[model samples]
Target: MAKQAKNHAHRRMTHQRQVISDCLKTLNHPTVDEIQTCVIRTAPTINKATIYRTMNRMVEDGEVIRIVGDDGAFHYDATLDAHYHMLCEECGALSDVDMPVLPQIDQYFPPDSDFRLTGHDVIFRGICSKCRAKKAGRNRAETGQN
Candidate 1:
């Protein structure tokens, strides 16, 4: 019976986990809070702890990548392809950067260096277009330009 239970557990994702995973896939680099909000829509009884545990497990299983924004919040992504991220400084929005990854940078080493680079994460930070537009509008209003 124990063996059967173990096998059953591995057979598929739990409904709660599936819901959380779906949220991760649908949302654009959502934080835990955002994920909870999305997950609650379908699984109203699921709580924050379960969501956090599931997301952390997914990260440990190498199924999701965690990105940190300027707000110091951990955002989750399900994209397994090689890519970088850009964070909006003004609104704390995060988006994927489709630029090619330069593997040569990982090969570069110091003289007689023993350091090794297993992987890399590069995050470019800037104000997103929406935030930029809002700032421009605020500036115009302040200056009475229109």
Candidate 2:
């Protein structure tokens, strides 16, 4: 019975972890508050503290990454691999940008360079397609009235 109880507990934790992982996977870069809202939708019994603790543990284990945006909100991403992020200034949308040549930059640096470079983060901020279209529509409307 004791073994069965332990197994049940493990399963429960696994379920919670899966819920968090799925939430991150669906959203490109979700803030902690957003993730908490998602967690509630899936698992109402899960508390905010538990979600926070799990996210911290996942970051330490390299299962996820915590990105601090200009808004001061910490966002979570499940993609642990190195890649650049593009953020929409207008809509706050986050998307991944693929650059095959990014890895070649490392070769240019000296092997024994005094500075240690583990990785790099490149974030491009601009208005996204939707926001740009909206702005154009507004301009057209104003011109039509004139």
Candidate 3:
């Protein structure tokens, strides 16, 4: 029984490594289905259940970061660096926002408070520059102004 358990764990770890490798290659944060698709190309025998289980484990272990997109779907990213996500409201585009960590904000809650500060995920939602420019152009055209 112990040997069986060991083999199972080994297989899971192997699949997880492949999943993480595929995730790193993806530039954009992809959903579980997308990750599974990528893994399938390299590992034809890997099933969706294994992919999902491995991904969830990776997220829990902090090997991968999970972001809940503006569309409410979970997306995975392998970048461990501290960063936030920006969602373009008009175009539904998601991009990384590189900025300094604001650890000082946790002090505002008062150290004696019941709330224990751990971490934060900040997602800025606004129209991207391209979307704003497109809207402006449409407005000008509607107003009959070149």
Candidate 4:
């Protein structure tokens, strides 16, 4: 009976991990609602509460990264890699910035201070190309410019 219980526990953990992993793999920087929706498609028995609990646990365990977008929504990322994010103000889109990570920069800050730097996240906020073009077209129409 003890062996059976252990196996059941292991299987439960594996399923939970798989659900979170599948959602992360399928979506990019998805919100909790998006994850719940995706997981429900595969495991209808899993509810929003379960997804929320599992995702929160995974974030606490450092298996996932939680980023707050400009719109104040939490986005989950499972890249486990060092990278930055770009947020579009007009469209509220979150995208990964593929820039190189500079460890020296972290060391350069407060060189004489006692603050230990673990890591950093840099987010660039601006209008995306689509929004910019739309604004430009509107301006041209108003000003009678081609």
Among these predicted structures, which one has the highest TM-score?
1
All candidates in order of lDDT, best leading = 4, 1, 2, 3
Q: How close to the true structure is residue 55 of candidate 2, measured as C-alpha lDDT?
A: 90
What digit string (tens of lDDT, one per residue) describes model 4 on residues 1-146?
99999999889878977977988998988988888888888788887787878888899999999999877888999998999899989987788888897777786688787887788888899988889999999999989963
Pairs with steric clashes in candidate 3: none
lDDT of 1 by residue, 10-119 (tens): 65347777888888889999999999999999989888887888888999999898887777899999998879889887899999998998777776646367766577
TM-score of each: 0.85, 0.79, 0.71, 0.79
Per-model CA lDDT versus the true structure: 0.86, 0.85, 0.78, 0.86
Query: Candidate 3: minimum summed lDDT over ten consecutive residues — where?
Result: 18-27
Candidate 4: residue 69 lDDT (0-100):
85
Would you list the rank order by TM-score, best first?
A: 1, 4, 2, 3
Better of 1 and 2 by lDDT: 1
lDDT of 2 by residue, 1-146 (tens): 99999999889888999999988977779987788888888899988888888899899999998887778777888887788888888877777787642877777778888989876677889888999999999999999999
lDDT of 3 at 60: 89
Q: Specify the poorest-scoring 10-residue window by lDDT in model 2.
A: 99-108
lDDT by residue for model 3 over 8-67, one digit each (tens)?
989878766865566556747777777777777777777778777777888888988888
